[model samples]
Target: MPENVNYYHITPLVNDLERFFNKYRLLAVESKELGIKLETKDLATFKPFPNKIYVMGSLKLSRNRKAKGILIRKEGKPVLNYSVASLWEFERSPDRIERSKVIVDYTISPKEAIPKEYGNLFTDDFMLWEGFSGMGKGGGRPAVFEGKPLVLPSLIRITPDELEKEFLCRNLGGIWTPKHKASAENRITRLQTFGNTFFPMMSRQYFPISWGSWESFRLEGEKYPALEDAVEPNV
Candidate 1:
């Protein structure tokens, strides 16, 4: 197995906020079972998880190069209020080199999540295809390919600084993170699941299952349970 495969993350389709939160809760529970803790926080207040996974919630970006705030929940609904200096802090931090992070954004409702103004900076069809193809063992397909190249809002191991300077600034046209590439290749080559039970169940899901190498096989069977069996019951 290749190195640097130490985290697995699933960024839900954000067309429906309620569904997004529901999926987040389920992912958190599954991560916990694998001895990994995932947290949702504003970029400014973000802290390293130290061998764990951190899922970023909605990030409000402005044209002024400063983050307006983050999306949070109140009264069982989504709200945006948490403030941040800049998304670049992810790279400035000393611990970032050793830490693994995945940006959990969604492609659903692109207008609402990623506006046209920032399209050049965030949209990348080739990278999205590469990542998904690698994750699903060559069976995954891009979700937002509307007659054009697909766009993946979620990214792994890429800091805002690199994103702006290397990818966006240079007009690179796609993600250039080496760790993400390595992780994708590693997963495609090493990660394997058996039995038609989990395979068919996973195939029926609407969302893609993009995970990192940090995840353990012990949780594989439980990770992608059938929808009917996976949904949590109302209290």
Candidate 2:
């Protein structure tokens, strides 16, 4: 269970989001691992596949858009729009998003920080010496926001240099890298951004686990109160 999860709320110019996601690389990888079959020709045939998060349909708001992520329950609490990479900040990162609920102290709500001037698009500045996203330093030493204060989570990677730059740039670097595109194969390219050093660990960590493993129904009813039991098995 990831302790911290980050969301990159991208409201792109792409028109057919469903088509884009169906053929999207990362989604495909996720589908393949989950035994999900998606076809661009069949939209209704899809479902996130009965999967907990099948695309959820893109979010929309006239003045602003919404995209929630990695929704999980921590200690029976709910965590929405969290970062998977940020989980490293959790003292006990079991990679179980379901086990851990959102910690108010940990979230710095980005809605207010939306860089609308940058085109009505922007995320809150969760970049701290140790926030949910990666760190930043700007210079070789990583500035305050860029500086890394702890280990990185599996789905997210931050290099020594990445931790130094300011949030003004870099957080969404992967998307521009062509790897994070809607095309799908971009998933590899997206993960490839981790480079050789971190990608190895991240690759292994991001592997698809059985669905019920990462998902929990505590909020949905099948209750299990022991949220953070180290003795419990990991997905």
Candidate 3:
């Protein structure tokens, strides 16, 4: 038998994403062999899905927004990419007129820093959060905030130099990168100013499994306890 295999599921709700990532992180810890890919479904269909993940539906955050993402798999112990996991938050604009729409609190897992029996699958690639109805990075998605739209480089490839420069701007909230509307030279200044507060910066650590009742944001859910045993290997 080979070693890796991947399966795909469209995560239409925040709770589902939280649950999947919890499972993904646990499997990584135990060095289990399994693969799962979660693609963000169009926000339009979110309400129909079971389990009202958040009460912000009235906020209309999904009315015109959509997110996208990948594919793969192997056999035996599948070679899963830790990059598949991410933590997102919806920041309410200080003005209340324009919500941040999406804020990626954490993307890289902290465990990757320590030596592990299995190994690490961490990467610096930033998660893509497009706007303008998915037409391009800058458009009217859900709601256009006061500042320039949140955009980043193509997830497919990011140069080493860019990664290094972006790292310098990491802050408390988390991060997203590769500047869309700004020049490479002005990247740091622009990012340090708005990026820190907006996207924050993707941090290295496991995000909380549950988000208590927080009315300011839409991403919230009950705790998804870890599995007692290694998940069944990808069949």
Indicate which candidate wins on TM-score.
Answer: 3
- At residue 146, give the lDDT of candidate 3: 25
Question: lDDT per prediction?
Answer: 0.24, 0.22, 0.24
Residue pairs clashing in model 1 are 5-213, 5-214, 6-213, 6-214, 7-212, 7-214, 8-212
Candidate 3 residue-wise lDDT, 1-235, digit = tens: 1113222111212333222111101111111223432213311222333463321111112324322221122223313333233324342443422112221222222211223212122211112112111322221221222244433311011234555565443555434343444342223222222242322332332111111111111121111111111123342
lDDT of 1 by residue, 1-235 (tens): 2231121222222122222112221122112222323233311221112233443332323332222112111122111111111111122233322212222222222222322221111112233333333333321343334354433333233234533343322223322322333222222111111121111001001122222111222233332211122122121
lDDT of 2 at 27: 23
Please provide, for model 2 over 162-205, each residue's C-alpha lDDT reduced to its tens digit, 9 standing for 90 to 100: 42331122355432122223231112223223222321112212
The TM-score values for the models, in the order shown, are: 0.22, 0.18, 0.22
Q: Which has the higher lDDT value, candidate number 1 or candidate number 3?
A: 3
Ranking by lDDT: 3, 1, 2
Cα-lDDT of candidate 1 = 0.24
CA RMSD of each candidate after superposition: 20.0, 18.5, 18.2
